[model samples]
Target: MSYSATDMIFDSEGYHQDFLIDLYEKLLKPRLVEEKMLILLRQGKVSKWFSGIGQEAIAVGVTSILQEDEYILPMHRNLGVFTTRNVPLHRLFSQWQGKINGFTKGRDRSFHFGTHEYKIIGMISHLGPQLGVADGIALAHKLQNEKKLTAVFSGEGGTSEGDFHEALNIAAVWDLPVLFCIENNAYGLSTPTSEQYRCEHLADRAKGYGMESHIIDGNNILEIHQKLSNIANDVRENPRPVLIEFKTFRMRGHEEASGTAYVPDEDLAHWRERDPIVRFEQHLLDRGILNWDWAEHIKCKIKQEIEAHLAIASEDRLPEFDETIELNDVFKVTENQYFEISGEISEIRFIDAISDALRLSMRKHPNLVLMGQDIAEYGGVFKITKGFVEEFGKDRVRNTPICESGIIEVAAGLSIKGMKAVVEMQFADFVSSGFNPIVNYLAKFHYRWGQNADVVIRMPCGAGVGAGPFHSQSNESWFTKVPGLKVVYPSNPVDAKALLIAAINDPNPVLYFEHKALYRTQRQEVPFDYYTTEIGKASLLKEGTILTIISYGAALQEALKIIEEEKIDYIDVLDLRTLQPLDTISIFASARKTGKVIILTEDSLFGSIASEISAQITENCFEFLDAPVIRVGSLETPIPFASILETNYLPYQRFREKLKELIEY
Candidate 1:
């Protein structure tokens, strides 16, 4: 019944030094083994190494308080955090060895190893980037009413990054149940903390962001455990973030093969004397909780286990690539040019395929949630998501406030917890508002840390319906430039449904394009059974002998009409569903068949998808081409509200007419 002052103040009688000592022997020793990994790297057993020696107590201490199902986002130096969370030891070692058994399947290095099924999100090396992601995970748990807390670990140096500030500000604003643990070890890769920051403690930075802050003695394991346990419980009850700053030291250089010659002698001596592992071991012995012989036995056992796991990991078979052979990146791909639609002139209307797909997809996936301005209740101005709110409840079909950045940020959070979120923008033109969530965060998070976001962002795009420049546009070229994002434009209902399902199921982020004009005008035969089409593959719509006509979305139907009327020979019409993967194999195969290429789209002709495809084809299939790659698209002019002016600016009959001329040429 007796409790220490620290225990009474935090109401953490459940936390004890005995548990701390046991955790240190089991979890903390792993850090010492990982420290040995740095030397392994120098011996060429591993490629690169990031050291986290002085900050072991903070990682181990904070993680001990979290439940197994709860999540944590540890930065590069928190391998101990993963160890505490029961991440597979062999997998961790395999990651450092760059083997298939690694967490990322050899796609990434050791630093990105937390995405395992153990519920730890993963670690991000791009200093402080994981904070926002952790905040997002926290927000998601709060929204879902899940009984979980998120713990995000960062170094004192990472606290200075812009993303760190953005995460803390948002976490405070939302009162998310997240704990931000800063391992302030005085040095951020050679530069001292005093040099990088003016504040006395990194925890003080929390007040500026309207968050509770605590400065813990990183060397004292019991104190760290009690403090973190208190904050974890408080966060669970109040659902708000708290900042815990652990004042520690880095016993080793910042990275493998790095020097600390600049480190002062007095500072080095002071930090060494306060080594957390040594101090905690002495604390246990002094308290008679553990004997010296028992402590020595624990250390020996940990080393033996690390070596055994490392050897097993080295010998373990990598994940079979055959399992991933059919796994294609989620992008629209074109297949078989033969027309699937039977009969001539079955009511044709010009519109983007994006709209039809959204309509069909909403009917398929009940869990598929869509949110945007005027989307659910208003059915969206484009009416692409019409009847969605009525069919799916408001919970699944949400109407977000005019906060694009916040909406997508929350969407990412939802997706992290296994929810599929399809966020829409009223117009592709206003994507600037959400660009921060898109380009800087969403697109880079997976590549930076090997995480996945099953999110679909539908942008009503392209100009031609006389809605004006802002209302009608196809700006997907801007999004496709980013890696780890699947961009697609469905040319018809079939591609639309297939790509929509693919985007919904895609592990990475997907940017779905729905032209405003295509909302209700275009219709096609999609099968009744719910089926998904693969991304990164293309559909060949028509066969012509002279030139291969490559187009997507609204332009594909236009090209089809023109080729049918003109009776073009062997015209290979390719419908690219996903832009990121581009179906390059299919494209090149078709290009070789026609020996001439013509790219068409409803967007502006200059610097469009056509331009990129042209350059790629010219470089790879130059010998096969009989003529220069041709392109047809909208004129480089702002779309006006007047139908006449809009028609003049948009690509339509002009594109169809030009393709006819090119076939003759």
Candidate 2:
């Protein structure tokens, strides 16, 4: 079944000469367009240009074998894939020009645009996160038993990223139908391949993950097409992952802004001699498939088309300043129908209540899925998902690799397909590993592009168990600063169960912070029925007129205990459930009534949630304030492992003393 280069060109029965000529012409278009973009770059019409001059053949050849229904998560250099996907020439030009008619509507000017209609995902600037997203898409297809595969493209440099390894491991373990193609251009920006990785070949790394691998000459389009065609078929049928490495070179620098000074002359000269476009053209001419005149005609026609599209796109209007208004739809949650339960209300621990909420949600919505490390059979590190695998099976309740970034990426992809995913972060501190996707992609997708990502990322936060810095950290402030994200932290079991139900049904991304200290400590009578507590709403735990005290998560428990133990009848307590969309109405009402306020949190004092609340109260309730607003937070040092040290770090006695001062003032 093997065919040589001569067999592909000369044997009419195996390969049609006309199809090769057409593909050659198609490949020429992206190169010409890229060259034209360089011209526009010099003329000050375009802001930046990331050239794909030397890698068009791989893009076109791989995309040619893909069906229209299949998806490709393409990077900035894969212009040929966009062209083959039927993306209009004028739209591409409009995007470069930052016009309103562009894919991002002038919000972004690079290749960060994708249409759901085209089944292509426009990549973010981050390199390897998309591989994990592709894994989720492939998982969706596998779950539905569809005969579709997902193709994700990256460079050899991306292979060095943690996300790359995590994604490959997940794909191999889950047997997902994904084609990971790496363009080995020998450089990651300015670093050479030798400095970037020590491996002999990028595809060789696939063996460690138990996946199939292939290495191909990128300049040979016929060979690439043939291999992809056969491999893609096998992947579609058998539902497993495959890795393909395309050995190519970058003729241009990373961008036009970065010239060829860093690259050696000898290397550039050697690669120029084997230019893919030139080599393909010579091959066509030698085989009599294309004449000199016909090739020239094709180039001229493509140039004219590029010019026409450029002219039209240049005249397209730019986005207005008024259109930059902040969008709040991403924080909006849908109201789910509440079902009543006649049975007696049961008092349960915070962790068990959360698990019951998840089980109820899964039973109500068939599309709801739970994914995390040790969450399947072992039922998570805290056993929040204990017995879920037995009840819902492995397909619905899944265990994932220890990849924080990959978990978020997969959840994002699942949300795109209208499925809800609940992600369990083993510890809140580990969220730093996945911070890029949560802040950049998941937080911005709804605002920039109108895509709703219905995902819940459960973060087990706060320090009361003496787990030390790595295991015990309250990281809610990191996400509260980000727009288009909902931050929820509950103080009691009732709100924990209700808010989790609401977060799962929400249309946007939600960061649900469950306090590790309160997981088994706090028990309350929780409703057994499926219900949703309103997001962006705070619960007024105790109402009073003296000093107003606001807190959330584990600290709220301390605040409540201090108020009752001290018999402070005039002090009010407010459990601020959602942080980002702060309950300003209730906060201001309490602040105005008390004329004094105190904010409490388990995070460090600097840049803490308490600081934000204090500032907002000073701004709006300044006239009503009789005393300066005060904030009580954990010490600036990391949470210590020693029980006494940790207790002193966030001592409830300090908070009690601070509240007495505010009340007396």
| Alpha carbon lDDT of each predicted model | 0.73, 0.86
lDDT of 1: 0.73
Write the residue-wise lDDT of candidate 1 on 576-613 in tens digits: 87788689998999888889888888778677778899
TM-score of each: 0.77, 0.96
Judging by lDDT against the true structure, name the best candidate: 2
lDDT of candidate 2 over 419-497, digit per residue (tens): 8899999998999999988888888787665677788999998888979989999889998999888899999998999
Query: Over all chains combined, what TM-score does candidate 1 have?
Result: 0.77
Model 2 alpha-carbon miss at residue 621, Å: 1.2
- The predictions' CA RMSDs to the true structure, in order, are 6.1, 2.6
Residue 19 of model 1, lDDT score: 63
Candidate 2 stretches greater than 4 Å from native: 1-13, 329-344
